[model samples]
Target: MQARKDKQVNDMVEKEKIYPLIVDESENIAYISDPETYEVIYLNQAMRETLDLALGEDYKGRYCYDLFQNRKTPCPFCTNDRITKERFYTWKHYNEKLGKYFKLRDKLVEIDGKDYRLEICVDITDSEVHNKDLERQLSAEETVVQCIHALSGNEDMDVAIHSLLEIIGGFYRAEHAFIYECNYSENTVSNTYEWHRKDLMSRKEKLQDIPMEYVAQWKEHFEEEEAVCFPKYCEEGEARLPEILQGLGVRRHMAAPIWEETSEKYGGEKKIAGFIGVDNPTKDIEQVSLLHSVAFFVSNDIYKRRMIYKLKDLSHVDALTGLGNRNSYLEKIEDLKAAHLKSLGVVFVDINGLKYANDHFGHPYGDEMIRSVAQGIRRYFPEYSYRIGGDEFIALYIDGTKEEFEERLDGLRDYAEDECICDFSMGVNFGRGNVNIEEQIGYSDSMMYVEKQVYYGSVLDGRRLQHKALARKLVRDIEAGRFEIYLQPKINLETGAMVGAEALMRREGEDGEILLPDKFISLYETEGVIQYLDCYAFEEVCKLLQEWIKSGGTPVPVSVNFSRLSLMGSRVVNRLAEIRERYEVPPELLVIEVTESVSQMEPRALKGLMEDFEKYKFVVSLDDYGYQYSNLAILINMNFVELKLDKSLVDDLKSNPKARIVVENSIDMCRRLNQVISTAEGIENEDQLNILKEFHCDVGQGYFFSEPLPREVFLEKFGGHHVF
Candidate 1:
């Protein structure tokens, strides 16, 4: 048909009348062009109208494609040899500039023996809008499927969801887009993910914790199987935007509801789960409706993840103490191993005396004790703690030091002490680099056991067991009358007369041989059984005093040794009172000797016990003064009745100038405080005794007087009148 039309155009041009034939002012647009140059030679009045040309515009030399198709050259289909390829060039295509489509029919022609092309074009865009809409719907569907993959492929859900929100927001030219996870049971919606277009104000943080009641109208609209589009706020009162939307400057919004049958955790019913919402978006009802596909796939991803986490909580969290369970610790160890470790610290904590508490106080109180310890640990290390055993907890610090962990450990101990929960022993070990994580953890565990032995040590584990056995044996011996007190004479430095005797403990062994401080004292102290031994020794001293009084002789002052364990217990005063009442011994007749370590005890508690001894009229002597850990400052304030110089001071007193000066200065300091100084230990020669006498030491007791003897022999040798 276009060939015959071009033949007619050629015949008309043969007559030199083609311009008159195509010049009608009608909707059928026609233009004549020089085929080789694609230059427009003539344009009909309808073509001029279609191009929106000016009344005086000329088009004789302009490129036709540039004018109509917005191309720099001729249209590819409008070729010089087009009639040779086909009878006519007929096609329909859209024009972006005009926001419409055009259909064109073209054919080659010869006018006035010159080759030209005749083109007729018509608008066809409005008739094909539905087909374009279908293509856009398919594109959006593919995008939603790709987003699901992106969300699932990433390990971090927050990052994946945020990326998806941005993609969706960008597709619709939206200012803001976000996901709100509506927790129906909790009656709240949490803003869980968001995207803010570049240069736009973010309302992600602001639009949070919204209750459904606040968006009641929005929820009502989302029940439809399409995006709830609010193109204009409050266009109808029944579909009014919430106040929050107004505050967010959201003039238009489109949201797709995520609905699902609820899990049993949320009461198991069909409901709107959450929604993906966009604010002030580009206006297109079809494009916005397509967002429902994204909401559907993303909501399922969220639900599946929540269920996985819920199951993980059941397996990974400790039931009794609510701490991370042992399996969690193993997982943490893997994390630690995988880390590029720099100054990673591991703290091993064990609840000391937990077995004792459980056995003696019942498991209920023991459970409470464990909970108190857990609470204390959570104060500083809330996230990394693990209950790896019944009474053991492990805490990790990825970038912490041994010193910082130790300080926190001390605070935990203090808390246990104050709460009376149970004592805890902790060890800290820190290292950097890709070192063995398990090795560091084991090292920390070993250190913790060592610490545990120092405070409320358990008898069932470690080196303390031997000491515990030794203490038990000594206790059995004391019960069987196998322990005896030996008195080492103390003499007046000035008067050259015996003034007192320091009661030394002696135990009869299975070999019927004598046991001195060397045989038992160290173990007793380490095992913390010294408190019992001290009480027994004091009772024996009382018996000796009563015997001396009944024999009708003047009894000298006898000082008995007391350990750190003796001063700390609440039962100390009562035990002393009971023994005092039993022995009928006045307080002045018996002196109490406190060891060097008393300074390390809780100062207020030790002071309180010391006051009680003072009230009872007992001579309170600070034993082993100037020894390791002993504080000379105690003498300056408390006015002790005597200061027994530690064996260290006397070990080299005769030869060492420093030792001599220490003893001398200590004696002088004691005199200033109105207290007496008694020197003991390693005093085996007259030179040592003479050194003490010259220092103005008020008293002395040691092997120089005589080695300690059994109770019977001591009574025979020293209890008699004028025995000195």
Candidate 2:
């Protein structure tokens, strides 16, 4: 028993020596204290060094709370009750006294049959600081992603900029964010975009045209630094704030410059166009990198907006006279329809003898004359003038008195005369309120035309004089039966049989020379005499049909061309029916041909005219089908027996594949519509004829068959019958 007792004492001594040695060598802080009295029992080397204790100092009477927390009483955070002999309690804590973070492991330990608290503390200050930096970097990356999404998702510059500002302001916890545009030419800056936190009054309205000198220091700093940061606004020092910022009550701010590539006209240098900034940021005010990234995107957007505006300006303005172009005039007309005006005045001005000048002098001289006229007009009505055409200008005045408008008009006339500008025909129209602009413009145009006619008559202009003389001569010739009917035979494509004849009008000149319709038709139409010619041709056709019927010959169907103007007249169908009855000719034997120009007429009116023709038992055929305004809606609505393809389409049938497709589809479309006959005009070659035949065209008429022949020649050749 004595030997065993001695061995136990020896073992205890050895264990105690080893424990102190191991604990002293550990890097972690370790300590032991009495559980009840809170007195320090043992302290490791690390613990002594951390607490500034001497290497061999006695810690027997010192309390653990006094050494660790600097308190006289037991620490409230002590883990004596929480720790057990079998398990270690672990926790992380920041020590206020030491200004460090620690990970602590606590356990209940026994010495001499008494319980005590033993704690091992691991310093984690550096780890904690590193973690915080990682979190900040992650947050900044997320903010950048959101800003990029906002910038790319919105197309409107205003909306995109506002969204970016909102994101940035919220990210930095700023009170305000804004963008300022710098105008180097004007030596000024303006707050173009701004965002403020909720309940904050906006300062954008008051920050207009601030002198560039206010931001001189900022510009200098921007050149040297990635961004300009003011952690705190100051006065009366090297860090003095601008008066503008002082007035704005800005406490802290950061900004980045927006740069743009200047055009060659401006020396092709990179310059600061604007700046994006935040004010009174609550956190991360030193993160200038984010501001620089946002500025890059903003600069691109500003450049794009400037280019769009420049192109839009070019499109709306005339290059010659610096006035609004035709497109602008059309948009203005639409705007005027919705505008509120007490009084409205319109002036229509046309430069007379423009074509004469253009033909005699070079185009440059004519252009100069036009420019002079435009300048004179602009002098009187600068704000509301447009060069709608090469030599035409229109001016509008709103909420103006008639007297005022007349005075301006007189001034314009005097300016033109005094400046020796080109001669002008001016027409004026005025209304009280909410008048029809179209009708007013039409009336003004008519007045202008009358004045132009008078001027042309007074002057010795060849084109205008010839137009007038031809118009008068045409009226007399129609009265004297100088207009004769000619016929172009329509042949059945497969059999070469004469199925029909179209009655064309020709003028017999005084020298016994034949004048084609092209030479005089447009002139007569302009003078409103073509409708009379149409009636005369119809009556003469009726007289011939009467003769053919009396001669007891089987007369083929004869088509008569009628102008749209003549068809629009009241009771025209009835008058045509009366002529048919007087001639005692069969209604089926006469076909009335209307050109495609009638497609532009009112739908209801055109439909009514077709119905009238049907009522009179007259067959109606749409002539010049593939000409201008080839509307399928007209064909669907009208009761037409035949559709005549225009000569232009036939001329290109062999050479143009697209035209061939169009013609083939057109023929197929007509075939599906109640078996409407498709006649191809101007089939001048055998290739064209074969192509039309391949497309199963119904009738063909052109020089390939014969030119237009006089009435006597047509009867002598075809014998007023279906000639095979």
Candidate 3:
């Protein structure tokens, strides 16, 4: 009786079951198994329908693999790495017989004392909807790659279009694809390429005349920014069908514009690149989506291809020689100015005798002469050349330096003299420290003119001749203890004690006299002899400061005026770097003054050059502030740490209310610009100094502090004292 009761209870449990066993509730087959022994213990009703096996009869005692195939061992893909410790694992399997994707899932489980896995699988025949989308995307990618390769293949637009159509036809399994090239010269759209599939030439040829009605719609669509898609079904009934569709058996198609980017204003008319029509209807919706994708891709690819071709065309000729230009020489200079490249040398070269050759031998021979000169120029500076002017050329040598540049110039000059009856002049400029390319080129051009005058035996008659003589005489006079480094004391406005001194350039010719830079500066400006004089004076002042420092003298900083021309050129930075290292002096102790004119030209390039000066922590002061077009925004943007007010502002402020207001506003603006405003040219008296002090001028350098004195006199009188 007890045994009968236990059987009845077991029967009740079996009837209820542990999990659901309904047919409609299950979309996929489900089964449970012992992981180690690989025994199938349970099967849902869906499993029976999937394997065509009876749930309780056929697969009850079988291993999981036995249901799929009679494998000698477990499937390689079925492993703990994938299934163990995971709630579920899913994968797809393509069935040859069914021709469908079967999405399978394996659930991790542990039953009784052994680990087990649950297998669930769905037929996934409907999943092809998603697969079709993916396949369409794949086709799109393939078409894009093909179009890229075709466009990149050649410069000929017709051939590129032909290749593109061929690729489209083959990729989409279409019977034919053709491109109608719009010839703007003739104002007609002609067939450039007509690709036909095998065994379909007659039908494809029958559709040669694609009819105006179909093309008219395309014209209207492009006019209204509507893309032309053919076949009523693919167009979703939005577009009219092409008449060619009826004769050629073309079930679907896509057409896009092949336009030159600058077509409208350039008198280029609308071009109808021929339609890409697929002969057969789409097997699935995959082909339905191909139209728009291919249209956009073709348009974009054609544009990119055309641009590449145009670029190749532009980059072909030599800019300097007006011959075949080198790649990137012209490119690099513009790039450097645009801040794309650094340390570019702008080399200015002038043909020495091209003018003479043109005049004496007539222009034909002169042209030949110029060509010969160009050949020689090419041999030395082979990479970059530009015909900037008739007899002038420019070259941009990357990573070029003053020395390398000089060597190249000298070599080119020698080569020109040796090979022909002419000479060439060259100059190089860059951004080094406070020096910039504009000033470098300016100086270089001046030097070139000077050298040219010398070459032509006209230096004595040129403007530079007198200036050159004056510079030489001044240099000699200075060396002979005639030139003096006048110390204009820079005083702290509040303390009235000298903190620094500006080394003003003064000279006495043969007789006893005090001459300012103005008297000889214009002279030295000719050959850039001012730069030389500055170097000489800078060295002398530095030596004096060194001795003062060594003798435990007061720490006094010395400021020197730099030529606006020199400071804006590359040499200033390079030379300053060299001098600072050699002298082993703190950059703070040596202040280099800059004028406002440097800001007018080459602001962008100069800003980039400032990094070199700022690197050594050098003090850069705007010597003549409130001069020129001084924009507070622009001034504050520079790397200058000090703003030196012009002496004109300080000297006239007491009597001039307008000047006083300007000074006060300038001071306010400088405070916001984070600049220490120093005053120069302030030589009136105590009243001007008091006004400067009230304005909170940080430092003052002028006659009020102390009159300009020689470096030795300055050291002897105020070296030990706190001369402020």
Candidate 4:
């Protein structure tokens, strides 16, 4: 009898419903349970009253899915089954008897290691709402399919991507959405699509709806192949993104990327194809997985879509110059830096006036002249070059070493002078290594003022008739091979072996007498021929230097004075860039000098120009330091690589204690700021050199060790001397 009673208890426990709790206080209904089972699992009074079910009828021993669904067993599609190792079902079903639709959600419970499934049923009897929800799902699927087809068909990629995002937003009932893609070639991710609700779009045409952090999250997704959810608009609660979103009234968003597979065969080819996202203004929560799937879908299709966008991208590229269009350069720079990398140089080049040539010869001749300069540079710096503004060009070089690069400017300068096409001025600068690209650009422009100051100073004399005539004669002679390149020995004060030499420009008159820039520079400047003269001198110097490098000459950094007149226009930068490319010259070997006083343009305008100069990898020096104490604020703000003391300071430092103190103070400040301090015009004796050395100057240049010589003469005399 005891064994029989135990069996009865086990059977009761095995029943689906065993416990019932219903009080007769509020409603006229009954809670039913199976006598065999002990679980209080029936919703009788509350559920029967709500759903109009019959009370007192027992639903004991019946499973949740079996009650709501027609199936006797668990449904195939169920999440409860995943959590618990039990047969389970979802709300999807067709009831042949009642022909009613009902949706159910379920949870699993464990008691003494035994699993039981609990569930709730919602009467989804309204056919309209059910059909509408189905329609929404179908619409989203169709839109995804359409985007895939468009992508596969190789249509206009940007437009297709934008439209695809729109369809996704509509399907998901989102207020806004966007797509971003990673470029395998550039290793960059850029915005591909963005859309806002029609209500918002009608109000604000330019929607600043997307936050940088959102874009940043997508980048992380691309890198890590993970999904991101923005629970709040801003994680730091800094109100930055929250403000923007609140303006749009958007509160929540979900983003994901289409990740590329890594393969040894395509070592450098791994990149995100694209990403898709959705945003909702009023919704407190978003369906994260769905958004991620949409993003992944978009990214997966990017490979074929890029082929179509390629043509559009090419259309924006200048065929003659191979540089980005004016419209594209600004956007490209922003995107490039947003990817968290620094541009080594931002070189801005302005071609000397073609208007004069057009008026004198014809438009065709002027165009050819422009083409010549463009072709030269395009062929030289194939990696990066852009014709951004009218008669203005920009180029970015990744491997720029300033001091080394300036030395190679001779070839372009010579080419321009020899052709006698047009004159040019250039300004170049260095980046703060880790600073924002905009700041880097600003600094470069400020350095350019130094070049511009000299340019303006040169053009002053050319405005007069007499000065013009003399300048034209001198320029013609220089272009006609009447100039010689002088090389000055740069002794390694430590060893005296031929280290390197400075390439100085001088005009060889009809009598074979050499005249330096100071003698005829005024003439060139006044005659509007300084650009040609500068180019002639520069190119001649380059040819000789190239030869020296080939003829077993010691490799030492060479300093070249790029006359302010020579760098008056943008063409100088491109021309120099071409020269470096043509000769395969390393940038570290070149040093360019500019007077700080020359770059007096508005800070905003000059900043980008100077930064562009440094992007080309040439060390920029203030040729005459201390003369422009007025502009020192801007100079310090722009950040020069070297502070070259003028001969005025060098000549007076030893004789005048005050002058020495100034020089010493300047050196100290430069040292603290990580700027190089060098002495120029150190001449006559070792005493001056010793004084410079004592002041802890990094380098010295002038006529004491040896005057500028011909390239061959320089190599013969100073080649071994420059070696430490």
Per-candidate TM equals: 0.40, 0.45, 0.36, 0.35
> How many residue pairs clash per model?
0, 0, 20, 68
- The number of the candidate with the highest TM-score is 2
Tens digits of lDDT, candidate 4, 1-724: 9989966665665453323212322343223222223233455455556545575665555654455444565546544435433533455444443565556444454533555554444456687456866866666566657766655554566677667766667666778778655555555555556877778663223443344454454565447546666554366752233344455555665667676665776685755556667777343233455556565656556654555567778867776555677667777777677665543666556655455445544565455556666654555455666786656666665545665445334455565455434555555655535646676666666665566567657665323323333354465565577777777665544454544456667776535677777876664554566777666655655566576579776467676776555676665777876776676667777667667655765656467557767788767766678764635675566656777676777787668998888887776777877655454455557777787677776666677766667766666656666443
**lDDT of each structure?**
0.75, 0.83, 0.64, 0.59
lDDT of 2 by residue, 1-724 (tens): 9989966754673377427634553878888788888887677777888988876777776888887897878878877788999988999888988889999988887666767788889999999978877887788778878887888888787898899999999988999999999998789999999999998999999988989998887798788877887743355345555668877898787899999897997799988888998999998876778899889878987788768987988899888888899999999999988887688888899987777656754465467667877888788988899999988989988788999999998999887555533578888899987788888988998898999888878876545533433344455567777889998899999998998888999987646688898976775676455777888888888887788778777677889999898898889999999988988889988999998788777888888888898889999999998877688888888888999999999989888999999999999988999999999998789999999999999998999998888888988887655544
Instruction: Give lDDT: candidate 4, residue 453.
Output: 65
The candidate with the higher lDDT, 2 or 3, is 2
> Sort by lDDT, best first: what order?
2, 1, 3, 4
Q: Which ten residues in a row have the lowest lDDT in candidate 1?
A: 461-470
Per-residue lDDT tens digits for candidate 1, residues 393-477, read 9988777667776787677667655543345778878787677788889999999888876664344543343334335445656
Rank order by TM-score, top first?
2, 1, 3, 4
Instruction: For model 2, state the Cα shift of residue 344 in Å.
Output: 2.7
> Highest lDDT among the candidates is held by which one?
2
Residue 668's lDDT in candidate 3: 71
lDDT digits (tens) for residues 243-324 of candidate 3: 7555555666655554444566656764555334444534332453455555555666666775787677667664435544
Instruction: Candidate 4: list runs displaced more than 4 Å.
Output: 1-475, 491-500, 510-512, 627-630, 722-724
